[model samples]
Target: MDLSRPRGSLWREFFLVASLLACGIRQASGQIFITQILGIKGYSTILAVDNVPEDVQEYSWYRGANDSAGNMIISYKLPSTQQPGPMYTGRERVNREGDLVIRPTALNDTGNYTVRVVASNETHRATGWLEVVELGSNPSLSVNATSLVENMDSVAANCHTNATNITWYVNYGPISGSDRMRISPDGKTLVILRIRRSERTLQCAIESFPDIFQRSEVISLTVSYGPDYVLLRSNPYAFNGIMKAEIGSQVEMECVAYSLPALKYHWIHNGSLLNISDATMNLSSLAWEQMGSYRCIVENPVTQLTFYEDIRIQAPRILSVVHREFSILEPTVVLLIVWIVAAGVYLCGVLIHALINRYSNRTNRAT
Candidate 1:
């Protein structure tokens, strides 16, 4: 063997190895940085590293403060070999670019993550923080009673959810407790002590974070109450509890009751049912027989309460007595005129016969 040839071959191999080492050191000096990530539970997330060395050949992932004593999640070398811990059940994987992806993440995945990338001769490292939170589903709203009577019935509203921070709203504004309003300890249930007609809309919402909230379906409240401030009016005239109408004239009377859920009307005339079942009563071609005390009974269907008003209807005052007296005097006046004429004629005939008899007796005595 020639000694010079062996020395040249050894020098050539040493120079090639040193050149490769210098190239790896240059690539390792590149920046290794990652960004903090936020994730929701039951979703997918990626722990991405930025500025990764192009000549990197190995990657290692850890789940703690640093790689010294942290739990190893995944490790990969060069092109194929991969090592995964119990945490990487088929849902987690490391891509060729040194990025870690987790499918269907959970709350336990929140922590500091460290990624170490190795080139042929040097190592590079990066750390990132992951924060996982749970945003629960939307809540549902319910009520004990949809309709309530004012000052008589009460209503309660409940917001059903698993969220911790809950709030109540009425007509798009915050609600506070008072003598007529009450709130539960957990702020889930709201009760109206005396339900009113003004309270119409109610809503419930969950505050997941500051300025981040979700609202449930809106609820419309219905309140029912009285037939108060009842009124009875007629078309022509209504004065001194009387509705005046002339004979053969038409009359219309209306009964008005202020109430919720509407009202049913019943009319009475002279203590007899009028068979009319509506708020308006019509009398076409009125007669003297129709004159009587008319009463309107208004009843609330929801509360089963009743209100009443009374009015007296009379025929025209001038025509009523005139017609009565004219009918009575008509027959009497004709009979009296015939009797007077007959008596006058009989008296005149008797006086003429007496004068004749007296004149004849005087003439016979003078002869």
Candidate 2:
């Protein structure tokens, strides 16, 4: 064998490696397409690799311990399309067609996955990361009794949700193993049994899968009682009209109080509470006896309030009439004044006639 021929072949191999490196750099600078993704919990999301180079014929996925940085891990190839390699369990494969899908994923089942595509006897790899998030459902709360009956012995409250394997709580107090709290066999409803008056407060909460799902609005209750009712009245005030009675006539000035518990009624005369046990209080109807302020007060000890009305009484004017027998009964001083006027008129006429006659006689004598 010639030493020069071996050297020449070695140089050619070096040149080939350099050229491949340049080609790989140019290819990497070009745009690659990622059309789909998976590892989603609820909605249908698929991992799709689009516009893959025509030269690539086989593809596989792999996983590994976290990279130097704990932030990421890796996935790689497999021996066959049906059988993945050691670290590539639960991975997907892509053939001439470029597509991958993961169904019903778990949160921990997430990491960086590396795709190795083989074409033209060369290998090309790309890495992508997956994040598996757990999505949960909402909850509903209901009181066992539609209408809350106050002062009742005990009651039941229940909470329900659509998700499975639920945990319940009330005001942050866990319901698990609680004597008054119980979960339905199906995990749909949570019942709080034998609720006490002190425990009348209720807060229904739920946890779905990994997180606290929701909390219900608070409900409060209190004891009940009967109606507290009372009636009110005031005293009578100063009067505008006159009151009349005969000399020996009896007059009764009265005040009336009306209320239940039959109010503590008092008769007030000039601001003083008169001790009258009865509903009606009486006073003398005479001007001096009944003239001052009068009031009827009605009060309730439970209510602690007093009502008053002012009243005044006045005596009627009295006039005397004297009568005489015979002729028009000399209408008294009025009749006497009339008679004196008539007598004066008659005397004036007589005097006038006498003066006129004397004047006439003198005229006759003079003539």
Candidate 3:
């Protein structure tokens, strides 16, 4: 890298970047493209160059279209060395690759910036524009209509901003022109011919630089949809398509559906509407009367769509646990009683045999 800029080199460098300082100039020897970029107020940004010759010895930067060497901001030697020029401000620096970096940029930074490169004996230079802007007002979004029904309603959304780099987002992601969506020429407005529930979150931002967003407040719209696919759920759920609960046990049946504006639930037993109106139906101490096809009707008031689902419930016969327990205990009790009786009989036989033995002995002794 050409790290040093001697006072004698100022006269030579003055003529290097001297021209009309137009954006992206092509020299007679080779081509050097200085990319145009944006700079935010009080922030850092880069003025990059492309197609630089590999045999570069030094890089020099100048401010504006000035032809005099006094406009030189800074210079960088071939590698990492830097020399602050006469016009050097504390905010400017040149990287090893010959790019100009400015930090905490000001409004005055907006203008044509020029860079000169010296490779071997050839001199190449180019200029580009840099527009510095303050982070402006947060974009405001307004829609003509909301709470619309899916596929049946359309809305016009407008983003209020003076920034030319308008970008639109749906559900926090970038969106482009589609069959159902259209954007105005200036990107200040968007129109959706048909709205869907999944496209409810709408937003806009200024992306003057790629991946950098000055975002606006999000707009959440409601698109009322169907009361679709009536669903049945239960506590102590159904077995083999039949909800079987022992008598005196409770069974809870719940109705569910996908709906907007909430769903109203009503229950039916054996084709007759029951008094129950909520999503839950509890059969406490289940009786035979509670046994039958329980139909749940789900309704969406806004969409006027209704769906129904059914769950079959049955109460098994009451279990006689006490009798069953006694049945299990009877055989065990009988076996125990037989064991005691046999033990007593064996004790009697042994006592009688001992008495007979003693009598016989006494008779023999008397003899």
Candidate 4:
């Protein structure tokens, strides 16, 4: 080999390597940077690289570690389709902007994500962290009993969940500790002391993290207390203790008791129990015999409290007169005939006495 030729070739090779190294440094300075992402379970998320070069020839995605040490999730070549790994086979795709799109992500998909981009003269690498979490299934709320008697029975609302942090809510707000409302240490159970007749709503919740939480369905709580404030009302009207109705008229009476879980109704008339079981009693036709004192007895089964209200059924005066019309007519007719017969006998006795006296005097003169 000529000595000059060897020298020139060596110088050219050295320059080429230096130029390539400079080009690599420039590429590294302009490499893409991926941002950290948080993904929710069963929901899709994206891992995107910023400032990707237009001349990239090949793209590779890795999970859990760096490009050389991590498991390959997918790879894409210029002018060709992408190839995905078994775990993300159909669930992942590379968009036109070279961003990774995961459809319907799972909890297992969370890990360190790395992407390598091979350009014409340089290689670029970026890494990011992905955290996956779940709000989880809606928690379940249960109670020892749905209904409790006031001051005599208590109830516990239990929230069931697998989460680490649990919370309790009453009527859409956070529950505060009180003499009547007691919360357990784990916040899974809430106890109601001296439950009253007021209705309440309870709910449970769990937080996967701050600002991310799931809540359970609402539960209705009922406390049965009293049969107080009992009222008996009639359709037409009731004044004092009486409810008036005409014969052949329809009448409706209702018994109302302010109590939880409702009160059982027992209607009584003239110390006899009625056959109806509802809170309302309907009479199709009013009769004179049906007019009497009507009583409504309302009782609470939970508290064993009882209430009584009475209303007197008064028939119209016209109805009473019409009911005895035939009996009055028959007695009046008999009394009138007896008076006429007595008057005629008195007149006949007076006339006969006068005639006998006159005949005795005439007989004495003739002798």
Clashing pairs in 1: none
Worst 10 residues of 1 by lDDT: 1-10
Backbone clashes under 3 angstroms, per model: 0, 17, 6, 0
Q: In candidate 2, how many Å is residue 19 off?
A: 32
RMSD of 1: 21.7
The residue-by-residue lDDT of candidate 4 on 34-111, one tens digit each, is: 543566676666666667788988888888658863377888887777987644557777765566777777888888
Give the higher-lDDT candidate: 3 or 4.
3
* Total residue pair clashes for candidate 1: 0
Clashes of 4: 0
State each model's CA lDDT, in order: 0.78, 0.48, 0.79, 0.76
Clash count, candidate 3:
6
* TM-score of candidate 4 to 2 decimals: 0.55
**Between candidates 1 and 4, the TM-score winner:** 4
Q: Which is the leading candidate under lDDT? A: 3
Worst 10 residues of 2 by lDDT: 225-234
Q: 121-156, model 1: which lDDT tens digit per residue?
A: 789887767778887787899999888888888889
Tens-place lDDT per residue, model 3, 275-327, is: 98898888778887877888899988888888888788776666565533434
Residue-level lDDT tens digits of model 2 in 234-291 = 2233235334443333455443443323456677766676778555554433445545
lDDT of 3: 0.79
